[model samples]
Target: MMLLDSIGSVFSVIALKPIIMLMFFVIFLASIGKSIGVRRMYVNMLVRIFEYGRQNIESVRKLQYSNLNSSDVDEVALTTKELSTDSIDQSSNSAKINNVTKLNGVVTQMVNGDTNNGNSVISRVESLILLPGVENCPSKNRDSNQQDEIETLEFNLSNCLDYVKSGMEAIIEDEVTSRFEAEELKNWNLLTRTNRHYEFISLRLTVIWVIGFFIRYVILMPCRVFICFVGVVNCVVGFAIVGLIPNKKLRIMANDYVFKHTFRIFCRSLSAVIRFHSREYKPKNCGFCVANHTTPIDVAILSTDHSYSLIGQRHGGFLGILQRALARASPHIWFERAEAKDRMAVARRLKEHVSDPTNPPILIFPEGTCINNTSVMQFKKGSFEVGGVIYPVAIKYDARFGDAFWNSSRFSMLQYLYMMMTSWAIVCDVWYLPPMTRNEDESAIDFANRVKSVIAKQGGLVDLVWDGQLKRMKPKKEWKEKQQEEFTKRLKGE
Candidate 1:
């Protein structure tokens, strides 16, 4: 009663924050109560911690345990040893470091869990074996066992860690040496590297574009507009005098010469957009190449990168310039949509093109249809019909460009072209799969499946089933299921 009365008197003397001070005392007491509850939580929490520690320690033990068991403490001392005298590769070293980092997480979890597990296990065991405050430190350990056991364990662990660290460093150095072997001069990975580097340099290009735009509007456009007006007047005057002079042939020649020169300049400029690359593959060649069908920009990407003659619909565009230029290039085997049902005629035409020895390799985007680049659409089997060898190519836009939101919408060709020209920094992958020879008995769908499998494996590029049409990037399980379903349907047709 006297102690309680004294505490109450002290509380009354306190000022504005009395409730806050009282709450703090309550929380402190609650924490003490929770500590009492920890024994109850130990079974589950300790199990998790133990699992983590076991995983971390397993790597160390497997790699270095023998060294530790030998009790060669000097051999176990990792710090005393130096890395390999042979110069190691930086990249391989980095990769090993990454692997080491993965181990770090396992180690941290191991240590944390081990500590927690140890505390929990010790607490539980102590309760069963000895009373906390008065328990005698096993009479033997009080003299030497405890100290020696701890030192031994520490030494074992240090050597184990050192061995793992050294092994990892060696792995990294070896990997760097392998990747940059200068012997294979064929820059097969040149495409991927260019895409990565292009991303870095794009900001500079954008700045130039922004500045060039201002310059174009301020200086070039007005002059071009005036030039167009003058050219129109001259043409009008020539047209007015045409009939009496009977000079139609001269006018035709003049027009032809002007357009020819203009075309050469345009092709040169487009080629410059992508640095010089030659992607000429023969249809008879034993390789496969796949493509994404979006806007005609997809065609330009192929032409600029690989120079493969494209096989597609005979569609005309502005000035008929693209159509004319591409037509002159061999392997531009075009067929109208109406010709699909006329299988014999279409196959015959394709066969002729493929038979030509002089013609460059034919490239096809079997999608036969364009979709929002957000997903890969189901492929059309037209290209599969001419099958000799197939190489699956996947071109996904890297994130440097806001890809998810940026494909051209609906039928807006102009906007689509503009968007592509400005922001389509793409990562193009060309995976050359071993050729699949035509089986006289194999149906087209089977061939398509073989092609699809080749592509899906390229980078797990698969169709997603959204609302109705198959959308791309559907989860792998679902994509595989859809593929199975498609296979069944095709078999039924066969």
Candidate 2:
């Protein structure tokens, strides 16, 4: 009896009491629809910690550089010279001739300088003199020499230099592959692997990291997990009950209420701080709501304010349960893998969904895959083809708080949630732009690209023409062939 009493006391102190208190706190916040400045305070503290860490790192780096000697500097200079000499030696004779020709042209241009009209007068004069002589030459020998030169079609090694530069750029960092990876941060966010070796820069920083680890894993993780569990349970049970209602109006009301509050609970689980701008342009009535894709949590973040009918492929496991629950109360379109691939069928369904006056605006990520929040990839034309108002929303996350990007190819859903719950916070801004409609003369692809540019501009993200699907698939044969054709045109001076 004494031992049992001791175990009960320990359990109540460590787990039971905190769980009950946290549950009540979360419920109170959800009911009131306001936060009590806790998140703000936490963010301020993080800012101070990050500043301190930055200063310490700078000091350490300065100290290290101060300790470096003259010998090391001389050695680095000598090594650079040797590398340059080696490169020069390895070049072929043709490449050397090409380089010499380029050097000579550059020197000549510099010596002649530019005209007051900002044109290269010498170059123009030389071209005119050469052209007339070729066209109006009377000598048979000169004409024969010119004909031979034209027929030879001498291959300049310099022509292929552009390919070398492009190859080197790809080897260093290509645009498509980098968009699917994590966004690089300018400062460490107290998360592991977010930055390189910042935690070990100073003993003080290391101690702070240890404390943050305890706070995240020991305290915050448990509270977040519990809140998330409650939210999921509420979603499943609430939607199931709402589905049984016979009245469509009441059912929609109940569904909206449940969805908004439940997703608000989810936002709390990640301690997400979302600032929405231009709420006047928020989606209303049935239309297409398009946004840049960053992560799966974008749904929860947006749903916290407005109830949207989600569109996606049928998922299983945890996502499957949520999808099944959502479908019960709302009209969400979940397609089979084969059906999703049928563009005609997908477009038909989208048109049908928007045609109805009663349906909520369908939220679609037209990029069709998650980008790293640093850029917006090509938007698929299916949604734009359905013919409706396009409500473009731009979502940009602050990486100093947390990395909200979901690299689905690298991490599973569960693994992503683990990182989110452990993160300091998920901070982001959402901009709801004015509704756009396709012009009568504009094609579906053109309209889609237009909306994509709007969102990318609003979010300050790089607007890329590359498909996000390139993360998994190779470049299309047609795309490669088109590039080859362009290169040939350049070679022929066409």
Task: Tell me the tens digit of each residue's lDDT in model 1 across 187-235.
Answer: 1111221132322223443454355446435443333333333333333
Top-scoring candidate (lDDT): 2
| TM-score for candidate 1, residues paired by index | 0.38
**Pairs clashing in candidate 1?**
92-172, 279-306, 281-361, 282-361, 288-390, 288-391, 289-391, 290-393, 464-471, 464-472
Residue range 1-494, candidate 2, lDDT tens digits: 99999999998789777677867797669745788888878888889988887777667766665555666545555544555564555555446555555544543433332212211112211111111122233122334554465346655666555556555655655667878777766556678957567777689889999999999999889889988999999899999999999999999998889989889998999988889999999998789889999999999999988999999878888889999999999999888755636666777778888888889999999898899898899998889887889999999998888889998888889999999999999999999999999999999988998999999999999887788888888877766665666556435644
Query: What TM-score, over all chains together, does every model reach?
Result: 0.38, 0.82
What is residue 208's positional error in candidate 2, in angstroms? 0.3
Candidate 2, residue 474: Cα displacement in angstroms equals 1.3
Superposed model 1: Cα runs more than 4 Å off? 1-289, 329-331, 339-343, 402-409, 424-427, 439-441, 464-494
Which consecutive 10 residues in model 1 have the weakest lDDT in total? 125-134
